[model samples]
Target: MLILPILLAFQTAEGSGYKTNDFALLGSDGKKYTVKTLTKGKPVFLVNLYDMEGSQGIADLNRLSQMTMGKVRVVGLTTLSTRGRGLARVKELGVRFLVLGSDDPYSILDIVPRLVIKEAGSVSYLSNTLLLPDRRLTHVWEGYNRWTLKRMSQDALKYGHVRLKIDFSRFPEKLQRGYGEFYGLGPG
Candidate 1:
């Protein structure tokens, strides 16, 4: 009976109280940004570019940016395997938010285990669709689906304290999988 509940626990969206850590990472603009710096009094949305493909999730972030009207900070963190692709896609789409390329993937090392543990319901705060308005985790999601975007929109509304005209028509219908946000490889 206990085993059944344990498995079912991870099948739904779980709550989070995970606190974020600070680390400086090199951005595509050739600048260094830390969680503290990006979040500074604004909600920071961390979107992971798992494959660095031209996923609709990028555009989804853009739309959320527009909806928030600059009230939130959305940063895209692509996997090391697909490093540099985020900046390109952001530039290609003329994205409003900052999409980063890693100069040092080690910056994420401290946080990955926490996220993984959280998603497994062993701890808290998983998913690349993360909301870190402060050091405390606001929310984390497992997939970049329409429902998640809607949740983000709700977040925007709460943070922005403004009425939003949301239109999900252009958003992608397919659900995108989450990546581990892992980076940097060492050779023995």
Candidate 2:
């Protein structure tokens, strides 16, 4: 009996479709910004990672930031309070993109490390939802894969008016191999 309500809550908590609620967050630069302001009529790649120390999440964000530089607006959102070491980690990571503080009033923290794309002022795609159990990644939904990255790049080109071409040759050998394995391009 109790399980039914729990399941219902979980279902409603997921932001799978379009989002209407605008986010107002403090950026790592100590400035408050809204989603629309940051996007500025561009396609946005929004990464939501609650745990600052998630290695995979950090690596993926770093790669995306480098790949989409000057093409798409890459923003990192975190629900964790950036009151202490959280702030330090943001600087230490040397993140080239804006890392904003997310105040999730809707309780969708479970479906985080998510990739949300916005085009022309509305959410066009949401993927890579991970649900963690006891700080351990238990579920991964179509995220950190080559297909998704390719699709995101395509969308940015189609909607954001991005003209920068993706030069995979610039990526490190390790990343190239990782992408190959994820997209089945090179020897697996």
Candidate 3:
């Protein structure tokens, strides 16, 4: 058996403070809004999605949207061909929360640098970090796995309960798909 090393980064909970590293993303209304401003000291979940052929991103969005509501703000960032394509894709995927423009990759990249995976044949996007009230990264889910997403969302709810006013159970069933999806995630 080969011994594998485990890397861990210990991050503490942040207090009430906003920082400028905060980015502005184009909202569904075509308005530029600061994520920090929207979060407003509450934990924020930023997800970057790509719509090519696979449905992983859509599935993730669907489940996350169902599970999160008032518990934590979840934003969907997509990279479609055009404005119309991005907006249309958002609707087709059944995304309930606000979705930023395709050019907003920087916002998600700043939060999680390793979100994009460029392989020999294809590309895979990963990571969705939960920002604490004080603007620190509290939890990070490297990939769009259901179990990990559930735990991350659950952890966010728990953290929200201890910091801000939130309702975890109010999160929808589709959102909990990260916990367990009978249908396997789509192709990469």
Candidate 4:
């Protein structure tokens, strides 16, 4: 029923040639990091920070991190410099997850171009989360939704050998993905 439409919403006309190159990002500590090195085999939840802002963003991030605690590692990726206000916004949200930014911002865009919308002055992402389970990368996610989290939790339990108990009240049951496809660029 509703899921059909939601799934349709996430369908992308553009083919996604997701690269496997090690994605490097700068942390607030002035250190360079990569997802493989950081996760250490744990399931990693990669979120684009600016894709979400304000109170709702704060709550969703905090809860998602808490929900998958230990079972998954939550990390944030940004195009901002590690030393800037973008880092400050992470603190403002009170999200304790590790956040890293790319020194060459285009690198971040390269990884998830479908998520970005670039105009004359501003850029934005339609999706907020990328849930990377320990299994196939095909199932790697590009949006925030209870179904995806639930699926991720299942993946974590089965693949990462960890259990999870998450409340899905705050997130929508359908999908918070690809709303941008109709508007502009979308997850590729």
Candidate 5:
């Protein structure tokens, strides 16, 4: 009993071990933004899409924008080159939040759909990544479900004025397993 509580307390204090990388991308609104600038000191929820043309992706972005408004900053990253039709599709979506075009060598396309949580410009958590080809879920992280959404909202409200700290151990067993797998502890 005491050991469990002690472990939870220690885990909470250690914080999530993910970090944000540096990159500047042009937004659909014709402005340039960086990951650090957009997230600033607040917690951010990022969704990376292979392209902006998918209706499901657009709907997800819109829904997330509304659900996280004023509580957590929501940003969309598109791996598709944002030159002609790609940029046009983003404009058509008319998403209220920021949508950035990524031209980085390691595009989101290489990986699956991901939900990244960042606090004070560093990644606090990275949710389970979904394999995009067949839409198969690898279950490697812990922020892509309804429970996580609610928890993130509550956390944002509670820690809006302070630096955020997430206790990963408090999450469900599945999430813990995913986290372990992501770090190569359990199974690959």
Candidate 6:
């Protein structure tokens, strides 16, 4: 009896204040960005990519860009130097989304402390994390998945740190089809 009630309260607290102390990366068109500054008052969708030459990375960016029509601010962070080759690739792909170069994966390091010392290789940075506009991390996915990416976009639109201009009903058909599928609404 008491156990059930205690669990419910714990869940509530988790949702309310789980995101904090996280950071993101932002860049583009020769502009530099600081995660600490960009998330000052808005939610952020931070994507870390190391292999920009791959098919999945390109596809992911394209899909994310479509959802970015003033919905969520998407930023791409890469470990490779964006010099002649990398720069041309990103620009040709029309990476209008912000792109940042990592002096170190400082953004990820600040949040997942273990990831900092872990001896993982390419697989590690491929993971993504979501942070609220005010630098609160709302969700984290250990690996890459389309469904999770889509859900993060939905959460940003629905309960984002900053309010959206249009109503949920006014959202495009693609967006409205599966709104709030993750939460599975029940008693608060």
Tens digits of per-residue lDDT for model 2 on 1-188? 99767533322223224333455677777777665576665566665544455534565567667776766666666655454565677877766677776455222232232232221222112223321111222222233445445545654554455654655444432211111012113233
Task: List the candidate 2 regions with Cα displacement exceeding 4 Å.
Answer: 1-17, 102-141, 168-188
Compose the digit string of candidate 5's lDDT tens values, residues 1-188: 78766544312321233233455777766777665566665566555543544444345446666655655666666655565665777767776677667566235433232233222222213332312112222222333444444445454555454233444343343222112122113233
Give RMSD (Å) of candidate 2 vs. truth: 13.4
For this target, which candidate reaches the highest TM-score against the unseen true structure?
A: 4
Kindly provide the TM-score of model 3 when superposed on the true structure, using C-alpha atoms. 0.59
lDDT of 3 by residue, 48-140 (tens): 464423345555555565556666777655455325767766666666777665464334434333332222222234345566665555554
Ranking by TM-score: 4, 1, 3, 2, 6, 5
Q: Write the number of the candidate with greater lDDT, choosing between 2 and 4.
A: 4
Return the TM-score for each candidate structure.
0.64, 0.58, 0.59, 0.69, 0.53, 0.57
Please report, in order, the local distance difference test score of every candidate based on alpha carbons: 0.55, 0.47, 0.50, 0.57, 0.46, 0.49
Candidate 2 lDDT at 29 equals 75
Which of 2 and 6 is ahead in TM-score? 2
* Candidate 5 vs. true structure, TM-score: 0.53
**What would the per-residue lDDT of candidate 6 be over residues 1-188, giving only the tens digit for each residue?**
88766533311211324554544333545655565666545676666554455434445555565556565677665654455555676877767676665445344444443221122222334445566665555555433444455556556766674433323232332211111111123344
Q: Which residue pairs collide, candidate 6?
A: 27-99, 42-133, 43-133
Clash pairs (backbone) in predicted model 3 = 63-174, 63-175, 66-172, 66-175, 67-175, 146-178
Segments of candidate 3 deviating more than 4 angstroms = 1-20, 51-53, 57-60, 80-82, 102-111, 117-123, 157-159, 162-188
Off by over 4 Å in 4: 1-3, 6-8, 11-19, 50-56, 112-142, 177-188
Poorest 10 consecutive residues of model 1 by lDDT?
A: 117-126
Worst 10 residues of 3 by lDDT: 175-184
lDDT of 5 at 103: 60
